[model samples]
Target chain A: MRYIKNPMEIEKTSFEIIGREMGEHNFTEAQLQIVKRVIHTTADFQYKDLLEISEGAIEAGKEALRNSPLIYTDTNMILSGINKRALGTLKGNAICYVNLEEVHKEAKEKSITRSMAAVEKACDENVDIFVFGNAPTALFKLRELIKEGKAKPKLIIAVPVGFVGASESKEGLEELNIPYITVRGRKGGSTVAASIVNALMYMIVER
Target chain B: MRYIKNPMEIEKTSFEIIGREMGEHNFTEAQLQIVKRVIHTTADFQYKDLLEISEGAIEAGKEALRNSPLIYTDTNMILSGINKRALGTLKGNAICYVNLEEVHKEAKEKSITRSMAAVEKACDENVDIFVFGNAPTALFKLRELIKEGKAKPKLIIAVPVGFVGASESKEGLEELNIPYITVRGRKGGSTVAASIVNALMYMIVER
Candidate 1:
């Protein structure tokens, strides 16, 4: 499908009406795909219009987060890119990683061998913005951290476009009381989700 | 790609040199597609085979659970379905759903204007077994619940299979401190996860 170019107008008009902005929010490729794809595929002006509105809300979220301290979800890729891509963004924060083994405590033998409990560690440290490149479970469980008073990221940027695994993380985000952006209706992966959050974080923090 | 007709055999024999047993206690979907789909079209079998070994330990968990009660992670679709499909299998035990409003509290405004808190309540009150649907997050937050004194389910049937948005939870069943059953690689859903748990419970509770 062809991508929609320059969704700024739709993004803006949406904000003016319902206060859900997308134009201003920084978005990764997958997130952009959702917004653009949804607009392209929508037959109804209402749904199309809704996409515009969501975009605008995303934009507002971006604006709200402009120049904010940011931290990437410490997945393998993002964690690896830290020195290269996260130099400006990570600021003074330590690229967080969860020692599931350490956290697993007494149940060490029985539980999940997490690649790295990056999200949990981020929350435990109370980082400003917890970015999920595509760790849906991390995004999913963030709500719990927020609840237990462990992890509380201001804005959770998730792009669940063209993916199946972490795509449903929107539900988790909603559950966690975090603000997020999705293309229109699609699943997503870690790289794309990270890209979108990165875009927004760049707009907000670096811009 | 075609779905594996008899995944059990592949899981037990060919996938790995040594068959996997039930998972360790702690650690750690349905949808558009009828069967399981993955990020990479190929080689998922390899991953499945490894996860199966982890899940085979469910019997140990069953024994542990028989001695105590089961705790839930939060309110989720899989956990909610246990009452319906699983009622017949599970009996004579104190089954509780972890009241989880904290996870969904964040996305209150995005989902058809429903309250995340309400959904969490429904999920928390749903059932004992999470049904182990939903793609597990890499962070393995479920470990936190068990370790932090928030949750303590005895027999966990981890089927870390997401039909679309959900992952087959059984793969990470090892992350939890409970005895978990990681079924065949792709057999999972609201119905599938529930049935397996119910069947297991029946095997246990009936006799």
Candidate 2:
């Protein structure tokens, strides 16, 4: 707020404000951290109610981070916003394959969204965490792959915001029996997804 | 497709793909450029029909870019994604005041979104182009300020994507006489907003 040039300080100040605004809201520390990051990104407090954090998603995320699992994101902004230094310490890599030729070719061949193709490609990469911030189709594809036993990620961050397939994709996540952190309706993006990843990074390494 | 590392080359390749996909569609050259960038970012060809580019918006944007006018954005990602090197060559700056302390304080006092407060702050900065990617509230507030004769921007890029006020906000943009590039429904974000800016940059300087 005070012309904060240091990214870490800016992030911390945002969390403090979020903490103050969330007074009396009941949530676990890890869930609260994710909520704070989401609020920090959108400045929308309704996320306090809309955000659905699974009982052990944060724990799963932390364990995945500790094991240096690859983080596959649906958008480059999510990849760019992650705490790279902290993740680097854990040997984790934040990867996004949205614009690759293979993805485009597969999407065309399979009659699917490029986001879906990207998720399919990510399945071959040993993904530990799947972060779908901008693409509901990607989240849907991930859910399908997980249910079919073709992919097994420790955690899923599904927060694709849009009128089309956003709510339904998150609903699909709920039925997967897999650990996930998601919002119920259409209210998320790369920024929110990246913030969740940062929260996980902080809990696993910074905290 | 070929693991293109050069940003310009990557952009050009995207344009090529967009050109192939848009074989029979009739659009002005400027409109095609904007559409290409939007598709490049989202990988969604449906944008061909969803996006609406005003006849004068690109011309207005190119003029503003050439004049080194101040650029206002709704999110940090939009600010960061802009080609700063080209902008610096033209002596312009991409500004996002949403996270500033002043915006947070004013938003609290006014019971408005920080994005709205940030737009109010930009009123004093002589903003030439207003790019709203993530905040419908910000776009709504800007419209209010413009109607009240409190602020005047040469061009507006209204593409806020979400379920809430996204469509209604873009509808508000249409009522204004100033030129704008907007989507009809709920589909947009910082990535699309940044792509529009990048397209304008390429048209003005990169080419």
Candidate 3:
């Protein structure tokens, strides 16, 4: 197996894996189309293979989010990726995602680690943005990259989410000089971040 | 009141807020000692005032987490914090902390929001052995900082981070380089990250 470093390549590989998994689930045509778009975006583009992969992953992820809303919406599952959480935000108006539905201690094909795995994917793919939820080490690395001028994330949000609001994450964003909006402290959550990103994506892509 | 961006100040505020809101539950001397130790270890030790304030706030936070760990431990909460429906990792001895008493969201003294607010307490107070059961956003921000070289946390975890692991919050950490840990998927509301972190702290601190 090849070591796929680019976000796009990683996304493409992940899409294929997701496709395999979704294959048994019987997705709708629209869902299938979105999945295909994600796969194609990550797989087919040759000009900017890496960037395309990341974009496709985001799109695919977006579709996954929109298509499958969480039935119970457990916060632990959101934390662990047992289910999907949907939300809304003002910035970009895109319904971005953070794949908490697949998180687990073991790195499996059908796990949230795939989404976190996107960081290497983005880095290798040289994607435009490297949006992350709350992987402290990953964010630390991002900070390192920013300090070295080796990374370019238009927005880097480390919104401090507590039992109350999204202020700390907001502060992190402010420090990073990335334009971001959070749920104001306790209001922050995976769903909140997803909603914000999703809303942001909708704003940009829909526009 | 001066605007302090320090972690201690943030945590102190959280303690005061939670303590006041939660019928003013004061910390015992032993617990207060632990709080002080956490403050000195996690916080910068520079903001004496913030540290002083955070001591109270952190104790309040620990009290809250122990008493009601599930505030941030919901699938929706986890998803909202991590921004993904799934996560996977090979490490991160994570755990899920929840208040076994099952209080309604409205009747609860500590909401998931407030628990997350105390994250800065751990960081600001220089408290090394800190734990968060449901505060996904706080966890996310911490991860982001670590990834970006803003914070250098040694360990991060989620334990039943949500009710019954109803929604896992460790997905974000699964993707990063941090020494993360969590319980098995579907092992909802278990002491996965909490126990592990405590164990780790025991191992490291006792050394």
Candidate 4:
């Protein structure tokens, strides 16, 4: 008949439950924060095993956050899920070009997804961080851009969720010689992607 | 290296994959649409067994959509994920009061969550449909309001995702003699909740 009513208490208790359920893991402090936040956003504890963080990936993400880096997301949902108030403290902004007129025109011309076109458009900008949540093609395109030496993001958070090419695109990201974090399967979403960014922001800003 | 590039084709292919993987189901035509869309958004097939829809729930939702309902959401992420173009065709609008000043004041005043406060504020509005995605407290509060005869909605899509009170709140909804659709456990999110609305809109508007 009763439960935690305060927002902070609810979040605190949720995290506590996550910590208790997860028990012990080999994740570093920063990686644990990202994993915990992801698991908190999604009640699935499988993220503990599915999430793969490259060596120093958290450090790279945190360093980029310290700078006023531009965070590019594949979907507006991810852009909406991000902690804007936290990003604002560091003078950073989250952007989603999927709905842009130029991106739409390019997608139609190339017969590609707007997600892919948006990533292509982002290649021209000074994007320091890339977050792909909805489209595998977007992650694949970003990997292609990186392979051609056109884009050099400090950190990439790729967790495109779907049955088609989601796992393969993340595998492509894992093969890249870049600092990145990704789920190893078809079990991630905008909420998980945004939670990672929020965890990174909270590490630097809220600390 | 090549895949479905056209956005419509990609969606069509994705739905085909879902249908193929799901094999056979006993869902009605309307229920199948909602289930397929949820599975499309989340690659998890457990939804096949997890989703619970009351009799005539889809009809209730469709009827509300036909009347230009004010769709109330618990989070901005869900409000952003909804297909605005489709909803616009029906003269329906999705609104989230989580960030409203009045809702914040009420939450602080009542010592409840902002999600619960937002639902309380929505109780005064002419809300035709209710969608709860991220907060179980909101669902519990709505169930309370309904129990007291304070509010009634044509259709309630309650799928609050978390480990805390998510399942219990949904169980509360099931106990009420109302037309509602919900995920049985802690396996739904804003994406799932928004996809249901989009599927319903697509059914009426695009068809």
Candidate 5:
């Protein structure tokens, strides 16, 4: 059978197929781009219904990207999967503190996960955008910090995946008065989180 | 609500929940571990039924890992996701050729993809274990080289994810006589591919 040999054509074809398969949707242009990119990454169409993009989340993310924000991710997988070239053009950088010595020491001392410790540490750095894709505890901690007025990220991309506290922690995002994008259930991962950021970067850089 | 705090305990609890939710299956002990890890990574239970492990595939993978063989992956995402510490313990290294200058030149010269060109270049290097997580074209090209008797990997983990050629390339693996592990449909990605390798390494190193 014939298929697209060029990488760019392959991705374009994949997006076309995703749009066709998704049929009708109420998502805005920005939301549709993020949803289509997530579906493209996983080949699972359920994301069409699962993704929740809060009001102004995409604009906030794009604005942050334009300012060369410090993008903090919960996992290195998300950091590695992000489009570095697009991010470089936008002057934004992605970082994960889960492997840091200070984060490890804090987790050990506080009897918390490295994910939680990393986010707690990140809160002090005035992170512009927060991306969580692995640990629900990190999301919960960030939520707590936000509620306490200790952390104030411009945009949050929370899609932590797991059996423990994943859905509940995401549901908690609804209570916060913050611009955020999240999956509605327990079906998200590092790829999904990174795809949202990449989609946002592509929106700005590619345009 | 209460939840796991320590990272090790969190992973242990997640696996226990997965085993409990998965209930009963026909997978062997090794196959079950691989499937559980995939499910853990994605929080998607579909992989329990979708994963296929040819006879001796896991054993072949473990044996190859033990020998410090070169693991060639189709994407840098997979390369970044693999457990570097465990692989270091085994003295093995993982490499992705998709971004190499020669691979890019070859793709442009031959009117093919960087993924396919990378695999073609790798065939000459005697790759021990081949892992394909992003490009179905790479998997197809590797299958072609193997059929031509130019490449003989000890084991192949083909789980490229996309709408085009993803399921077809994985289904094509059934036609080869080589030991392989794959997801039956288009529901796999870099994380799933890297999870299998990490699970195998954990089995050997953690034991």
Candidate 6:
């Protein structure tokens, strides 16, 4: 095992290696940052083929992010991983209502998952970004709300990882004709989702 | 998109599907629970191959859990995802030092990552379980401390996801000759680590 001189150095070297591994991409600079961060997190190169980025989605996401949009995630993991400083600079907030008492009660009453209930709650609010990285049901519920004209987001990041409804939910997302950055199959989680958001935030600051 | 009737039902169905996908294992009931939870989180059956559980590691982990062993994690995400009720019932506490003021200061002073500094801080505490799901540097630091006989954990869950030093750190852990549950490659994260711990806690309650 090689000795790690320092964390930053290791991270920088890793990013360099990832760029070499995933060379010759057609993605924009903004989108490339998000892709590299995802690849950096998972070390899975197959993401090149699985990831589907809608046309002009990165620019749209960057614009929404510059507005300090209120971000919502299906899981607390994604909420906590978000760069608070970046969000704070833009006066934006990241909220995860999965464990809220009201959400729990509503889910129980409605016979739905807490994640889906959380999305339903977001639907009523002025949410700018929707990120689902754990619960596919949440993405499915979000799709329904968008269809009914109850919710509209600048960009939807639907990358829930699991066997049950993961692939199916992303497939549903593909038919929405709305803007999204999603993995085509059952391979994603809060880490990847948060990385995507962080990449966008970093791009905003750097620009 | 399909509607989720309830969280419990969806989780039950997912577990059943996982069982069928990973048929006929020699794992004990507790081990099987951990395996199923990991598969359920990642939807990657290959985890069945990547995850390495040392002999009697589950029993050791169970003993620590029953004793309310102090839990330490590399990320806030893992800390937030743990079964707090189970830990509370056992009079245990989950601690994440990465965000601590002292950790940040010390890491800067020592020119290391906050995660590695957190491991140094944890090495001084009365910790029983070391869960590293995000930072391989933390895992490597822990391995160093253990080699110097400064720290001893009842069980180490060393599954950090990344390209940098991730696999090498787990490989470093294998030579420690300590009881551990680790994934051999770069296919793990805070979610998977937290799921493994939750599976252990649930098995404890179920039994």
lDDT of 4 by residue, B87-203 (tens): 888999889999999988989888889999999889899699999989989998898998999888999999988878888888857567889999998878899999999988888
Residue pairs in clash, model 6: none
Q: After superposition, how far is residue B175 of candidate 6 from its true place, in Å?
A: 3.8
TM-score of each: 0.34, 0.59, 0.27, 0.96, 0.96, 0.94
Question: Which one is best on lDDT?
Answer: 5
Candidate 1 per-residue C-alpha lDDT over A16-49 given as tens digits, one digit per residue, 9 for 90 to 100: 4322332354545535544443322211122223
lDDT at A170 for candidate 1? 54
Candidate 6 docking classification: medium
lDDT of 2 by residue, B142-190 (tens): 8888898888899999988654566678885667788999977766777
lDDT of candidates 1 onward, in order: 0.39, 0.78, 0.34, 0.89, 0.90, 0.85
Deviation of model 2 at A155, angstroms: 8.2
Let me know the DockQ for model 3. 0.04
Flag the better candidate by DockQ, 3 or 4.
Answer: 4
Per-residue alpha-carbon lDDT of candidate 5 for residues A1-207, written as tens digits (9 for 90 to 100): 466787788889889989988999999888899999999999988999999999999999889999988999998889989988898888887889999999999999999999999999899999999999888999989998999999999999999898888888899675788899999888898999999999999998973
Encode model 5's per-residue lDDT on B1-207: one tens digit a residue. 477687787788889999999978999888888999999999888898899999999999899999987999988878888988899999998889988999889999999989999999899998999999889999988998999999999999999999888988888676778899999888899999999989989989963
The TM-score measured for candidate 5 stands at 0.96
CAPRI verdict (incorrect, acceptable, medium, high) for model 1: incorrect
Model 1 segments more than 4 A misplaced:
A1-74, A80-110, A113-117, A148-150, A160-167, A183-186, A201-207, B1-38, B41-207
**lDDT tens digits, residue span A1-207, model 2:** 112323345456556766776678888777887887677655557789989988788888888889867999987778766767788889988888877888878877876677788898889887999998877667767777888899988889988865455667788565777789998876677777888888888876854
Q: How close is candidate 3 to the true structure, as a TM-score?
A: 0.27
Ranking by DockQ: 5, 4, 6, 2, 3, 1
Lowest lDDT block of 10, candidate 4 chain A: A1-10
Please list the residue runs of candidate 4 whose C-alpha ends up more than 4 Å from where it truly belongs after superposition: none
Candidate 3 regions off by >4 Å? A1-122, A162-178, A182-187, A201-207, B1-23, B26-207
What TM-score results for chain B in every one of the models? 0.43, 0.94, 0.36, 0.97, 0.97, 0.94
